[model samples]
Target: MYRSRPGATIKAIATDLGVNPETLRNWIRAAGAGHGRGRTEGAPAVPGSSVEADLAAARKRIRDLEEERDILRKAARYFATETGW
Candidate 1:
């Protein structure tokens, strides 16, 4: 409905769409359509090869950190009780 009108306020769009104005705002934000505006200009740029590799490495590092954190927590608990603290 908002698309059809093109110049309607968020409240008006929400009323026509039978949804809350905030919900419409969230939709706009997530779609990267900009506030009270239409779809963004130009096609999204694809990540470069190096960018993809970096992301993979970051994810692996995150997983390793989580495993280390769990091990440290378990060791702490074990030592805490063992030392009668």
Candidate 2:
């Protein structure tokens, strides 16, 4: 969704959508997910508090970043071994 775009701000998207910024923020917070989202086992997520789903998303992001770092490391080593001379 457009909301996930880089550098996208709440106020900007809300303006584009013809909605109040606070409302948009609430919608975003509400969408943090809950017991039925990606979590398989955890406490029942409260409506206003989506800690579980957010944690899951953060953990997945960490894994993705780690993978990207590994790829970059390999690329760096490959380029380092190549001599311009």
Candidate 3:
């Protein structure tokens, strides 16, 4: 396939396939094989990325912060009740 070839520009491939470059690009994206212009230029994404791990950690931290804030709010309310404020 033309996709596996090195230095295969969309324009060149489109011309060879007798289709517009945009059409070929759209077909590539629709097929779920597209990675923009990066991979073709040699910036490949590694397998088993850490992005998901980082995102999960961030979400967990946000949940922890929310819980801490709620506990502090309850404590403040309890102290106010004890002091009749």
TM-score of 3: 0.47
List lDDT for all candidates, in order. 0.77, 0.68, 0.76
- Candidate 1 versus truth, CA RMSD in Å, comes to 7.5
Clashes of each: 0, 0, 0
TM-score-better candidate, 2 vs 3: 3
- The order of the candidates by lDDT, greatest first, is 1, 3, 2
Clashing residue pairs for model 1:
none
For candidate 2, write residues 1-85 as lDDT tens digits: 3334657677888898999988877766665532222323453435435677888899999999999999999888888888532
Q: Point out where model 1 deviates above 4 Å.
A: 1-47
What are the per-model C-alpha RMSD values against the true structure? 7.5, 13.5, 7.9
On TM-score, the stronger of 1 and 3 is 3
Write model 1 residue lDDT over 1-85, tens digit each, in one string: 5545777888988887899999987776665665545555563424366688999999999999999999999999999999999
lDDT score, candidate 3: 0.76
Global lDDT of model 1: 0.77
| C-alpha lDDT of residue 69 in model 2 | 100
Better of 1 and 2 by lDDT: 1
